[model samples]
Target: MALKINKTAVKEAKAGDKPQELRFEDGLILRVQPSGVRTYYVEVARGKRVRIGRVGTVTPAMAAEAAKRLSVKVMGEGVEAVMPVRAITLEKFIADVYEPFVEHEHRRGKRTAEDLRRSFADLLSTKLDRITSRELDAWVRGRREDGVKAATIAREANQLQGALRFAVERKHLKVSPFDTWKAPNVPQGNVERYLTTQEKAAIRKALSDRDRQQARERASANKWRRERRYPELPMVADHVMPMVLVLLNTGMRYGEVVKLEWQAVNLTTRTITVVGEKAKAGRGRIIQLNDEALKVLTTWRALTNRTTGLVFQCDGEPIKSIKTAWKTIKKMSGVENVRIHDLRHDFASSIVQRGGSVYVVQKLLGHGNVSQTMRYAHLADEQAAKAVALLDGHKRGGR
Candidate 1:
């Protein structure tokens, strides 16, 4: 139940000797709100109802909506709040509000969130409402230093556009800066690089090496797992190498891949179930396991006590933030500029290369929307090219 406020009367209460009161569903009043001072106010609990802080001092209509939101929040709905409706800056806006709102997305969005967070964090300020196309153009233009690709820059820039659009919809910003802005020509650099069958063999070989080392060093499994307040990890053998194999097989976020619990993963069905609060969306997801991902899990399952469902934890602790160790693993693997997340792109890319449809790829990636899956469509095109190339080669001469 929600309290409905007759905002017009609430304003009248502020103006007259007899204060007008509008009660919210939660037993609070719109209370006595004055014009040009504090948008919204509510009465608190106890014998004497207390007034909470004012949301804004804008207008009665606006104030009413703000009151509605507080009510929604108290009732456990995800109410969209206008934290700093007038104050707009990349840094301050993000600091004051956006961080808490998108904390859940960080678990699911993975490298996408990681990359966008870095770009948005840098913009600092360029006002949400008044952002001119010139400012946005210059914003990305400045970021295109030392040969940063335009496509990557454009993807990050789109986030600002989305944020501004949201602000405008909520009337926080009067105009979207990008409305007048023209997009720069985005240059496509590398086509998607998925692992070849041979590349898979190589990664499999590395996984096998990890398996063999584990066999020879059973005495050290306890030694390697033990630590004194995050002591230097064995770092390479147990978690690092196998993790890449896991990523190669399942299109999971680094967070999702590492956060895998044995309890969530069904060895019989070869699928992993992802739960809320650990996922980008505050909902659970299930990813089907391929033979290779299943094999890695099988080897891993025996070494653990099934006290928890987590499949990929280290010792008794869960693996969080694999950045430092991954950097080392990358150097050891001799792969340049290849990220852990690129493994997902690699997974999606492999699906398309092997003739998987875009629709199928979308489901495998577990995207809330298909646009995220569209990034790998180029791999599908590459498949088409190979088909045409074969047809031409069958003729006497290339067509």
Candidate 2:
């Protein structure tokens, strides 16, 4: 190891190949700091060192003894739990330890992995050994104080916990500091909101108006395009009634509905089977086609390529997203609170209101749990009311 010395002492010691300010030679490296304090560091390891203690005065003998003691302590602390420099540096650990674990959890969606990745992009670049637990605690505390949702903060904290656990397993960290960190409280309930019958009718009506307007605009545009002798008009019906009908008919998610394959869809049996990892639940389910859904499917199938292998593809590529079209449709339909997932809610609600049981609804909706199926229990309650009325009528007739 080496000791740092103040300048005046070095000049007095007739130091060779060293600055005059460096008074101490053994176990210390010198820096004439901007703050004017002669800071002291012990060279505990080769090319790696720790600041032992600062000595303002240039005392060579006293500094050497201090450096020797501090070096021994730093070395001892690291022998058991404290991580070495190679393990805790900014560039040293992120690529090696953190990102891979986050990505692995992301695949299974144990949490919102991508969101966590974005949130931690710069944060994890900090050196673990240099960063105090108090700094991390304050960072979390600041986020909470900034009006960020408690639930969101809790999830982020959980992700951090997972990262720390991974570090601990590799001994880069001694223990997960967040093992006892509390997450925000969340309430229980599967409360759902659905479009009323009138609301549903108004939306469909408004969609029709929007589709007609779109058709007119396309016709005008096509007239202009045809002057150049194009093979066909570029007028598309993808943003029309056919699309809305497609979503309402099949309770399939916007993503799933847009990416259906003709080979997977059995038009003869009016069944649509979807199998892909793109599903949020990561499981495929069979979609039953009603008359409205079937008609739309048939029309779409005939309108697109008979030679092409894929169904519902536009411009020769399978549709990946329809969010823009949905946004336009919602505004046209006059349903401000509507979401694409609400179409799914609409399907389950329709099934339940039309005398389907919760179990049937569960199967139709492809929910993993029955608790998710019970929000439609109110529909079954309607049947009980009908039964009660029938019983009252029979009792009166007997009297």
Candidate 3:
């Protein structure tokens, strides 16, 4: 029989020869053994019981409050929330708890989750307490052997360490194993590749040629469909070419461009507003569109016939990736050892080479600090020379 458990009821409860059970309204139970010892247990969910404490250790009131807290914590953080920290494995924590929480809280949570899975595949099954500095050192050494760059290795390690820190914050672990591990040093302002003038022209030509080819293919397919009395395909231009052009011209990150809504873009003002939530730095900023970018956007908008919703979408949905088209563009352009990210470096390099200030470049690229933009300072060699030349006052064949 169950009762409304209280101090008097709990105290007056007698034990039998066998274990006697006293159930309460809030899933709180007092189990009395034959020796007259009482212990508290809380049922967080169906058939899931969590031990609280003994009666002499914790009063009925204290036990009930603890039970309520346990139930609430379990409801919010899942069953692992109540489990001992050492019992949870790194993989289980990521899959069962961390991933779901981040997926709800962050825009790039899915990607972050995928990165963790791929980067730490070998360590996923290891328990949190089992992860040691020696293991991490070996992993870093292995990555170096595999020809991974120090920066790439550092980024991946930091992301994994972040997940471990989150576990500590959530009380899922006593401490993060990464707390003692030193991350690989990443060089500052190491700009790897910037497109040359000829390369840029070749890429532009490739994009234009791809668009024309797409149009021809669509036309031929539509003609066949018309002859067969089938529905004709829409002749709208694709988002890849225009999106790449926008990235190159605006120096906007791919994520920012993909999530960009029409409401954020002011065609009349020739500007784009990167929302704070979607921006990498968690702060919003405006990007002034260049003549080439403006024209590309205008043509794309006209072709798509959209004035609302996402600026670049596929079948009325936000685009996931442009990898296939990007590969084709690279092959067609005959450019070697260039990545999509290099487009942004090229944009910054061009600005500095054309006498644009570091401050202006920082603002355009939405960098958090001037130091990040200093990679292009060397590219401003000619501009720097001109500035120094002004110190001489009236350059007449070097005085």
Decreasing lDDT order of the candidates: 3, 2, 1
Q: Which structure is stronger by TM-score: 2 or 3? A: 3
The clash count of every prediction, one per candidate, is 19, 15, 0
Give the distance in Å from residue 284's predicted Cα in candidate 2 to where it truly belongs: 2.8
Best by lDDT: 3
The true-structure Cα RMSD of candidate 1 reads 15.9
- Alpha-carbon deviation at 220 in model 3, angstroms: 1.6
In model 3, state the lDDT of residue 185. Answer: 57
lDDT of 3 by residue, 57-124 (tens): 99888888887788789878997667655458878988988899889999989888877876676787
**Candidate 3: RMSD over Cα atoms?**
14.1
Clashes of 3: 0
Q: Candidate 1's residue-wise lDDT over 171-263, tens digit each?
A: 567667777777888544453545566656655565566556655676465466564334443433366656777887887767676666667
Between candidates 1 and 2, the TM-score winner? 2
Ten residues in a row with the worst lDDT in model 3?
183-192
> Which residue runs of candidate 3 sit more than 4 Å off their true CA positions?
1-190, 386-399
The regions of model 2 sitting more than 4 angstroms off are 1-191, 225-233, 276-278, 306-310, 318-320, 390-399
Stronger candidate by TM-score (1 vs 3): 3
Per-residue C-alpha lDDT of model 2 across residues 1-399, encoded as one tens digit per residue: 333544455334433343333424444655445445555555555666555555546355566776666656766775333224345853455566666665575664434444454445445567654445565666564453222345666767776666667677777765455654444354322325578888788878877787788889888877777887766566666534666677777767665665566777888999988774645366777888899888877887776646336666667775544556666767776776565667777888888787878887777667778898898898779877887789888898995
